[model samples]
Target: SQQGEEDPQALSIQEGENATMNCSYKTSINNLQWYRQNSGRGLVHLILIRSNEREKHSGRLRVTLDTSKKSSSLLITASRAADTASYFCATAERSDTGRRALTFGSGTRLQVQP
Candidate 1:
């Protein structure tokens, strides 16, 4: 099973609408983060909410984490066509490799109509 998994595989909305995505994991983590990708290319970090942090927001995005339930959610406000991309939640486990590696969820693909 994936360390992090997102639900509602895809979503479609219009500009000015709101989009929400959810992720669930199976293990303990030091932190959880959200990322965005366009056209399946490189990802850009969006927000990071530590295990101890319950919620965080940046610009039109809001993220919430529930360590106890091992779940997280992301909300995009006033969606725009520019926000048409895949949103992912990733977490890093303590690795013996001595380098942190991210385990990404399946991801939520958002389509915003202009």
Candidate 2:
């Protein structure tokens, strides 16, 4: 599997702080995406950075991709209690059938203290 692996399996921080998570993959990819899942709910798409891009930002979230190193990092600035969730990094790669396939990491569990 081309599934990525997230670092710092869990994190705890106070509200208004920043949370950062890293992900590393084994294969080449077309694009990488970050997703947030609140407890038992579905995953919410956060950001997507193409292989040709080095960095991208959305709201208070920043994502950086290093294609040479096959790694990516997600940074959430001014985090809040509502931002507590399991963050995952998904990589999109072209499959043998010429279709894009997504592989997700184990995820980083973040807890923001109120």
Candidate 3:
């Protein structure tokens, strides 16, 4: 599988702080996506950075992609306790044709304490 690898398996911080997570992959991908899961429930799409793109931002979320390094990072500003969750990065093969067969990283567990 082409699942990406994440670092800092776990993280903890107080509310109003910022949370940052990273992902690394071995193979080429069409795009990299960041998702958040609360209590191990469903995943919520946070951002998607295309291989050709360098960086993107949405609301309080900022994502940076380094295709040369095959790595990506997600940064959340002013994090809140409600932001506590697991963040995952999934890689889609360059030839993917709309399938969930994507390989996902182990994910970073973030804890935002109030």
The most accurate candidate by lDDT is 2
TM-score of each candidate structure, all chains considered together: 0.92, 0.93, 0.92
Q: What is the Cα-based lDDT of residue 106 in candidate 3?
A: 93
How would you encode candidate 3's per-residue C-alpha lDDT over 4-92 as one tens digit per residue? 98877999999999988989998888899998888849989889898899999999999999988899999999999898899999888
Tell me the whole-model lDDT of each prediction, alpha carbons only: 0.90, 0.93, 0.89
User: What C-alpha lDDT, on a 0 to 100 scale, does residue 37 get in candidate 3?
Assistant: 88
Best by TM-score: 2
Off by over 4 Å in 3: 96-100
TM-score computed on alpha carbons, candidate 2: 0.93
lDDT by residue (tens digit), candidate 2, 1-114: 246899889999999999999999988888999999999999999999998999999999999999999999999999999999999999998466647868999999999999
Q: Is candidate 2 or candidate 3 better by lDDT?
A: 2
lDDT for each residue of candidate 1 in 1-114, tens digit (9 for 90 to 100): 577899879999999999999999987787888999999599999998987899998999999999889999999999999999999999976456636788999999999999
